[model samples]
Target: MITNDTMQASSQGAQKVILTIAAAIILFATFENKMPGGMIGALGAMAIIGFVLNYIGDRTPIISQFFGGGAIVVIFGSSYLFHKGIFPTETADQITTFMKSGGFLAFYVASLVTGSIFGMSTQTLKKAALKYIPVILGSAAVACLLTGLVGMLVGKSFYDAVMLIALPIMGGGMGAGAVPLVQIMSGKTGMDAQTLMSQMVPALAIGNAIAIVMAGLLNKLGQVMPSLTGNGELIRGATAEVESEEKEAAVDLKMLAIGALLAISMFFFGTLLSMVIPMHPYALMIISIALIKVSGLMPKAFEQAAHAWYKFVVGNLTPALLVGIGVAYTNLDQIIAALTPMYFVLVFVTVLGAVIGAGLIGRMMGFYPIEAAITGGLCMANMGGTGDVAVLAASRRMKLMPFAQISSRIGGAFMLILATLVVQAIA
Candidate 1:
């Protein structure tokens, strides 16, 4: 028996949500032809677009079960919008500019890295460090070989297939993986930057899509074969007794704000170190944060704050960040134009190679095969930061962000170096 007041309040809430969405759309439309600046215009459009895609993905059955819901939807949907020219050029450009120069992706990664690492116990971190690096190296090697073999079978040259198809897919993500690889190739092979990007970007986009789908499939595999997963625990035989007793603090505005500051501060520290180290800021950040976590020096209050902030950001900002990726990073035209049976088969093989290699090595290292493949292998093959979140979500293992980041950042750098050497040898 619902009262009139309750019904009225429900109606009001629904109206508010609709009004907010409508307002966001209006703002996007207003700036359709103008290069809008600041978070208000660019981030606002992304939020609205991402929310709609997320909602649609969740309600859709096949997509939810097989493709990890909103993440895939947001990428493909935004790509569609851009492909059809439905999203105006100016609006799309604004989103891309913000994602790149405004450091939206950096901000998102920084928050997750800082919060997630601090929230974990020192013991789990230590156990993870022992076995994770092997999984990354093994996956990269396997993926490259399989993709190269498949390329030859499909009548393509081994170098082109490995460099253009396999390497990009396995290289981590766009900023850290594909973009840098393009520059390296252009310098060594005398290929135009645009030509190299044209070939590699599609592999990344399609590989990311497959990785997300494979994540969901792997999650299902875990259920059918329970022994193949640690059920969100990365370390084999790491007892849950200590972690189960740990309580999550009630999320509050103050705690969230504090968490935000901590995340940003750590990101700044990582950037500062990168000045001398010549590594990606994210790689430095991951190493620095892990040391801080393993050292047992962060205050409990600060740890809680980081944990709370990670939750808030992951829950609220993921879709927005994904929208930024689709608009700024994904090029639907390139992906579609590059589609062919051989290309498709090669991409599939690259992803499969990663899973097989990671699964085998992970089992040897005492990790669940399915979880290892998803985090260490698939996370590596997918587009960097956004792909990590999507694959983990699809596998229902958000707790593995630390390892996933390592796979993306450090592992990506490894691939870049490998590509450089390979090019030099062949040239």
Candidate 2:
């Protein structure tokens, strides 16, 4: 007779086979244009496609070792599929509509931000706030200097290089960085905002792609030079008090629901406050959450719930979100149209400078070099909130979400101010 252990193994193997066959059937149906319609069809298609790409990337040798495994593959692969019309049109449109109009990206990030802030120790949070801005500044400074110098070598002016390429690359993302930046430059230089946008969009796109790859490389470098990283931790000498707390905290379905509600409520509050704050809703939400955490006002149960909710969302939805990012946000044609040897080099140098500058300064401020660089440098170079998620996920440092948001929202706001001054000076 078969033993209990053997019986369990056989059962698991059977379950896997059944799931695989079901997945194959769904995918085949999808390809044949017979998939279900609306949200079910869209989500099913994205989840299935994303899971397969993620699995391949994770198992592929070089990709698993250095290119962010499934995160990279899900993003780039989805983009390619969407571009080639391989994804069903109805499903693709639904995914895009869900990501953009349905507010899935914001919903996802709000959970992370709320949960992450609640999960951190007050001391670590305070220290990070103190040191993070300077790191962003250092990264931006070095990136601008390097990109401008390279621009001169490429027959472009220093101002154009810094203002057009470096600033936009480091300015957060398109809406927060390039759009307002174009308007500011237009007012200063008498050029149309649309014209300025055309010049800056390519730089933003290329820079974001480079930042993602660099995040993966940095993760690999951390593995090779373990001392330079804290694995997922940001602060160098900080104890794992949060992790211990998480282990001790009790979780249930009620707690998870509470956490979800708290996350969305904070986001709503942020939107309400934006009327008076003159900042991004995400920035306001972060500030609000940070203040609440620092004040010790929220109940311990609620905090634990929020953190648990965050963990749940991240574990279950990251790949799906990346799929949405690729199909909804990425522009293959724009990236290809902007490709040129000198331009690529300039973009690469800008991102490289950000990593170097942030890493060095972050180490000085008692943060792990790799963690600091990924948050302060790569986040700024990415496409705002979405880029932050992609980069942090690629680096396998999801716990650093709080710091990454600070870079995108707060650092991005700082860039807008800097652009104003630079435009006036250069124009």
Candidate 3:
């Protein structure tokens, strides 16, 4: 009884469903005795899982509104599955190997760091660069102080509060924050590095959860108090001066390839700089890209190409990368183990400190309070690269990535320095 068009539509939809099931079956097979053949298997599994979670999160009403859609869901859901032994051990191990040693995370971040910086308007870069650091520092100061106070009130020493809770929360997630911190603390205190790391890991995980959820809440807050947000714009009144539209860059496959080349080259350049200087490659990469952006070193067409590539990557790859994050980085077992009344209180206070501190100073600097709090504060509070993306995506402010990176990289470094000082004093 159906017309020709209806039959075609039904056929196509059925094909899509079949394709999804086939992919899912292939992914599951990769878990069977033999190792899934490397990148292809890993990416296919991540894509299938990530998109499914993304769909579930989007379709759910209230959760989507306040929790920033599928990011949190994907992370938690993947972790739960892993913890519950739903994902086979071999499969989980493969995903982890791909994420860490295979450099999936770095590859993903490099594209974002390169494209976002190059795509930004010069004036916005200049204005934001000059003013953003103080906002980060303010958030850090308040976060540490508040956490320290809360710990003391709960009968924990001020050092335990700041070092264990506050530092990890503000330290920028696992790679940039906890790993380096454990090394530094172990050297200073003669504690086993693994032991120190175990203590700090909970704070980082819990803090990341709080930050992601808070980002959604802050987005809603911005809407209720319209004056407090420039929507995705970080600076108030600065949006008018900036040409922030993505529509101008026509979608071209050649341009996308050029963009990928530019991003990878920039990442390598940062890696090269890291050899001569003792800084993270990402920080150097940010500095290098920002300098070129402000100096007008690249041509307009090059910039446009980079922007186009960034659009392609962000649009196409974010869900898959997030799935990689869930399968690899998020450890729900650790998070669950770390939950305690005092621990929860301290983490909550630290996030609260960031919101209050960044919000006040951001308002003073003519930035929307909600935007500032989320990017400067919550981004610092979340897990490093993935956390920044999750938090910003939840807030619908992906454009604020540059500032969020600043918080995670530079601000995380600052936290490390402070932790060293705090540990020295304690010792």
Candidate 4:
């Protein structure tokens, strides 16, 4: 018989294997049912992106950052345009029929809801739903304003449907979640309903992918950015909103409970209120911040729960989200002629602009180069989504994790809102 320690080690190894197997099973089972086509395509896409990223990352960092996105845009955007007859479409009726189907509609909505749900980084039960508001709301508002302008410029009707994709890419895609708000203009009081719906689906897919990549790229940049956000974990007031190094210490049951309550309240209120207010999340964020503030008011305010709550509100959704994205995008080759060039232009200009803008904005707020750069990249990612941000952030080895995530998410909400407006106007 084996010694006691050997037995323990064997058991431990078995448990680890079991856990890995379980994780895989859960992932496939979830994807098999929830996402159409399957996760194979999704995994494939990630692999392709990863391989290309690896190669390019070693040579030209910035180029690698924007490389994959262009292809997504071309395939999805072209298919959408052809379906809508904006381009030379084959069997426009079929395209329309497929796009307008309930299955496609459900897919889009499910992805959105899941992305939102899985993205939440909270521990409290209630705070789960509320977590999506500020970002989404900001996304909606900014989208609306821009949409109105685009609509005004593009003659504002069904003919302008293709523009929705612009917002998704512009926001780095995760923030492109706001594209659904394009439906706002499709209502009885909104623009042509069919037109808006047609473009929104693809925008959701492509944009989210872009967002993921943007996140990655931003993280990569932080690895190379001049060190600046490396300040010590000073005695930050123990708030429920703490995102600093002390997050581990700040987590606890009470804070989690509070976060859950807040998230739930926000979702309930957001849904309830979306009916009445155009600028929906204004109240949501203000209230979330207020509550987050309240939770931190006492001694153990955000002690442990802050981190826990954040996890509940926004963590571990990337794989599924990406898989869903990959499954739907069938035409990989077309990406070259279709999406990359424009996406490259957009990302380059936007990054350059954000860098300049963040510098100005940072000076005003008293942050440093790395802090501002990471934050600016984060804004780009969230406005774009996680994939893009992740790709951007991870492009380098010594990435600034926290700053990149926080800033991108924060900026994502705002940028997406702007994107929505621009998209709606065009749609």
Best by lDDT: 2
Q: Which tens-of-lDDT digit does each residue in 1-427 have in candidate 1?
A: 9999999999999999998878676655634654356777788788778888888987899887766777778877887786578878777877888888888888988898898888887777787787989999999999999988888898998888999989899887887888999998998897999999988888998898889889988887777788888887766776485477457888889999999999999999989999999987878888998898888788888898998998888888888887887777677777777789899899999999999999999988888898789888999999988788778877778778878888998889899999999989978
Off by over 4 Å in 3: 1-35, 244-247
Q: Give the Cα error of residue 5 in candidate 2, in Å.
A: 1.4
lDDT of 2 by residue, 1-427 (tens): 9999999999999999998998898788778778777667767777888889888989999988998988999899999998788867766787898888888899999999999899888878888888888899988888999999999999999988988899998998998899988888988888888888988999998888889888899999999999999998888877676555555477799999999999999999999999998988998999999999999999988998999999999998899899999998888889989999988999999999999889989999899999989999999899998899889888999888888988998888888899998877777
Q: Rank by lDDT, descending? A: 2, 1, 3, 4
- Clashing pairs in model 3, backbone N/Cα/C closer than 3 A: none
Lowest summed lDDT window (length 10), candidate 4: 230-239
List per-prediction Cα lDDT, in the order shown.
0.85, 0.89, 0.84, 0.39
- Cα RMSDs, all models: 2.9, 1.5, 2.5, 10.9
By TM-score, the best candidate is: 2
TM-score of each: 0.90, 0.96, 0.93, 0.47
Write down the RMSD of candidate 4 (Cα, Å): 10.9
Q: Model 4 over residues 1-427: C-alpha lDDT tens digits?
A: 7899999999999998996675565445333433223334333333333333233343554444543333333333433533444422322232233333413322322223222222223332133224322332333333334443444454544223224443443343432344444444445335575666454444444343444454344444444663433221111121233344232444567766765554445446545654776533323433343354445442344323433564543233322223223333323333333354444333333333444445444434444443444344334433333343233323331122233333334444454455456545655
Question: Which has the higher lDDT value, candidate number 2 or candidate number 3?
Answer: 2
Single out the weakest 10-residue window by summed lDDT for candidate 3. 27-36
